[model samples]
Target chain A: MYKIESKEVSLYYGDHLALKNISLQMKANTVTALIGPSGCGKSTYLRLLNRMNDLIENVKIEGTVLIDNKDIYARGIKIDDLRKKVGMVFQKPNPFPKTIFENVAYGLRVNGISNKSYIEERVIRSLQNSALWEEVKDKLNKSAFELSGGQQQRLCIARALAIEPSIILMDEPASALDPISTAKIEELIYELKDKYTIVIVTHNMQQAARVSDRTAFFYIGELIEYNDTKEIFTNPQNQRTQNYITGRFG
Target chain B: MKKIFSRLLNHLITVLLYISGSITSLIVILIVFFLFSEGIGLFGKKPTEDGFIMAVNKSNTVNHLNAEQIKLLFDGEITNWSEFGGKNDSIILFRMDNITDYFTEEQIGENFENLPACISKVVDSIPGIVAFVGKHYIDKNFAGKELQVDKITVGDFMFGKLWFPTAHPVAVFGALPLLLGTFWVSIFAILFALPLGLATAIYIAEVAHPTVRNILKPVIELLAGIPSVVYGFFGLVVVVPFIQNAFNLPVGETAFAGSIILGIMALPTIITISEDAIRTTPRSMKEASLALGANHWQTIFRVILPYSSSGITAGAILGIGRAIGETMAVLMVTGNAAVIPHTLLAPVRTIPATIAAELGEASQGGLHYQSLFILGCVLFIITMIVNLAVEFISRRNRRVAS
Candidate 1:
């Protein structure tokens, strides 16, 4: 059964349309990667699931998005509830200007769960899951800024995890990190899929191929191909997918 | 030839630019130099008017009187000479203008030609008499003992409790009351402006739609451009009555009213800078917050405010700079009272207001005029310190944001 689905989704940013009608589905506890060049609507499509596009000015979204088979765009849908179930990691290691413990506990605090032990347990678990636990365990009260670049990115991931969302969205999460940090994040994504459905947008085809179980190639606001990661990278059926994956053209 | 012409034009432009910049700096330096030099001159000089002396009856053992004691003695606030450790006698004050009361006009003679003898007789007979007379009035054989009060000192000028710069015989030039009044008004102005301005900034940066923000931001900024006198006028006409009615105070032109006006004046600075700062919260951070199920307000309170804390601090200090240096608005509404303000509801006078109200009436090169300049010096130092604080906060703001 599909954990998340978009039926004929189209998005417009004022006069210009950013995403064309695109249908995609992802199974529960699986990693899906969106590979595209700049301005290719991959990020736009990823933003649609959590309704992140609503924050932009003059954004007009059409069609239905389903998470856990519930239409999120329907009337009476609470954004807070929808967002709580959908976590996102950004391109930059954008941790809150807070301590590591507070940054992880931020989700619990915002969601109004104030039991101290529960928060501590959840924060420690999230940090451990993001593979940043041992490195920062002794200094959880220190500022998140004191961490190295790779550790900060993992801390952000840990922050998202503390929300306990079933679906996590990664928008070029490893784009700003060093090679070793990229490897660690790719490794973390592989581990995250056993408990959370994951969707990621990336410019790097190899990273996408390594981390994602399913791959969707998008170009100029249209989904060109959607298939198993191996098939998309090794046996792409579309011309543009072939060109993008093999570096013929972006 | 064209290259040579362009080079010559470039040289001319450089020279012109250099000259204009130097001219501007030179003018500012000259003004500042004049203010400090003249202001500092108030010290080491007697607070009394030049060529003026006070005379006590030869029998009266009052050796010297300072500005405050003389003012009190003349004003009838002090009824007996014993207040200054003199003999327990009711004080009898005499002035040049009171010659008729001391003696009949005919007895002093037609064009006051016998005024000298009459004054001498009055001073000699009135044992408790303290006469404030010019040197021209005293003859060679005057019976009264002339006394010179101690010169004003910087310590007295800064820490003295009285602020009677125009008091006769000698003027008290205590700066304490004016300093406290400025401090009191500015602190309250900040208390009024900071939170309100920060809320408006948050609305503009975080909550308002683009069209609303565009309109609201400029309009709030335009509040700063409105002349401070207009704010003073508004304070006097509207805010004063409103406060007076609300608090049931006897008068409305008070420190409270001055603070309200100054806070209004400061709003534009705080709002504009704070909004700019609030707007600088990285989009990535905001997205991250929202993605974690944080509401808009939560995102704002938890992420944006903390992220831009330093910048908001800079804005607040700059707003304080505006409130501290503001003159006309505070002047028109603060009742111009030169007493130490003990409460916000009371009438008070800030430094700039004191200078503006008194500068016109103060005679040039006198103690009053120079004290006003020193007030300017104090104001300059305060604003300079505020600006420096802003610089420091802004630097920290940048470092944190990155």
Candidate 2:
């Protein structure tokens, strides 16, 4: 089933064109990696999925972004509820100052879920799915800041998962972490494909190659290539994609 | 040679700075030493039995009377000079003011034996009156006039409801109510200022934009630089009447008025310090909370406020110190009444105000004068406790933060 689709979408920050016309479809139970150099609109495109750009004043966008065949930016749509369904992990681990358990339970609390047992179960399950349960279960009540960088990143993932979002967006999630933590994140992304549709933005070509079934390459705010990961990496139709894959120039 | 000369010049500058600093410190230490030397003398055990005594000077007249004859004359028992079998004369009442330049300690004869001789002569010469004499002069006799009384009673000394220090039994001040009133007014001033000041700080720190903050911050800080007497005048004219009319009271010069004025005056110090602290909260922490879906208010309450609480508390303590040490504003608005104020609406007196009002008229070594020194000691102790508390709490907070 189609989880999210954007058609002829363009994004602008005031007078500057941040994203050119683009069309894309994301399927359920699949991981799509969006790869580009810095300032090439990958993060902006990812933010568009949940309307994170709405936070910026004077941001303008054309065309429609649909989730499950429903236009997300349609009149009467609530941004809070949209955010509840579309979870996002930022470039850096941004955990609240609260304890790990409370951080995981924040979305649920905001949504007015008060059942302690259910919240506890969800929190544990999310941490387990994020592969952070064993490492942090002993110190769940400690402040999230007490954790290492990698542990904090996993804790943030667990926080997103605790809310049971169907579409998970990862924007350079492993960029701020070490190699071992990056591999762990890659493995977790592979594991999450069965339960959630995932879109990841990355500058690491190897990370994209290892974790995603399909890859989309962007350059200068325009989609340069979109195809199967193997095809795009091994036999690209575009000369820019080949140059980028072969490490000629960004 | 040039380098050596420049080095010598630098050394000279450093030496001069060091010497100046040392001299300043020495002057402060010497002033404290002097106050202690003069003040503690009153507490030392004197050989005389009485706390203080007064007698009439006998150099001006000859009165061949025994101690009983003089005692009877001063008791309002004998009204005329004939009671002492003297000429038919009305008893001459010789007080210190009526005496010669002896009060100024001018050289007398060949011996400057009695300083303040006029004070001594007034004490020794009265036939139908009483006067003041120093404790050191009790044994010195000139022309057969002797010091009459030993100790002044505590009741007659203080709260005789009268304050005539030149009288036979001078009023010794018992400062129970005045001390209590001082504490009450200071505490109320702190109470009035703390919340409003802290709230203003938070708004300036967290909520205001840069332009608004820049404008408001200096305005508030400028409030501190305004002369305190101006605040006193404003309080007397505006706050006093406002409080009076609001409460429908007979007069507006009450402790509440004093506290309100002091509280307003203290706001700049408290708000400036606390706002600076709040503004220093790390932007990373704020972003972290915001990214976790907490709004501005929640982030402020949960993160920024807790981190800045120590600074806010320090500012409050500073404001308390300011309020306790305030003189003019409180004196003008507090009605300067040395009574135990039972309610906020009643008139009150604080230590600084009492000292300012009473010190000029108080005789140098009288009990009332000493009482003001004791009040000074009390103010010093109160400020010391507040400083110590701020230090202790700030240390504890630093430990927890680390």
Writing each residue's lDDT as its tens digit, candidate 1 over A1-250 gives 6999999999999989888999999999999999988999999999998999998878998888899899999999999999999998988898888999999999999999999999999999999999999999999999998999899999999999998999999999999999999999999999998999999999998899899999999999999999999999889899888988889887
Question: What is candidate 2's lDDT per residue for B1-402, written digit by digit as tens?
Answer: 999999999999999999999999999788666555554443322212245554434542434443234444555567666666654556654443544533443543335465445444554454444444445644544432554332433332233232322334333344566667777887888898888988898898877877899999889989999999999999999999999999999999999999898999889989998888788776655644444455567668777887778878888888888888999999899987776678999998887998899889977875556656756766777888989988987797676455
What are the runs in model 1 whose C-alpha is more than 4 Å off? B51-66, B73-148, B244-250
**Could you tell me the TM-score of chain A in candidate 1?**
0.99
Clashing pairs in 1: none
lDDT of 1 by residue, B1-402 (tens): 999999999999999999999999999999999999989888788887777788888877779876767777778999888888889989988889898887898998888888888888999999888888778878998988886586778777778778998877678988899999999999999999999999999989888888998889779978878988888788988999999999999999899999999999989999998988888888988988899999999999999998888889999999899899888889899998999999999999999989889999998987889989998998898888999998988887777667
- Candidate 1's displacement at residue B184, Å, is 2.6
Model 1: how far residue B108 lies from native, Å: 13
Top candidate (DockQ)? 1
DockQ-based CAPRI category assigned to the predicted complex of candidate 1: medium
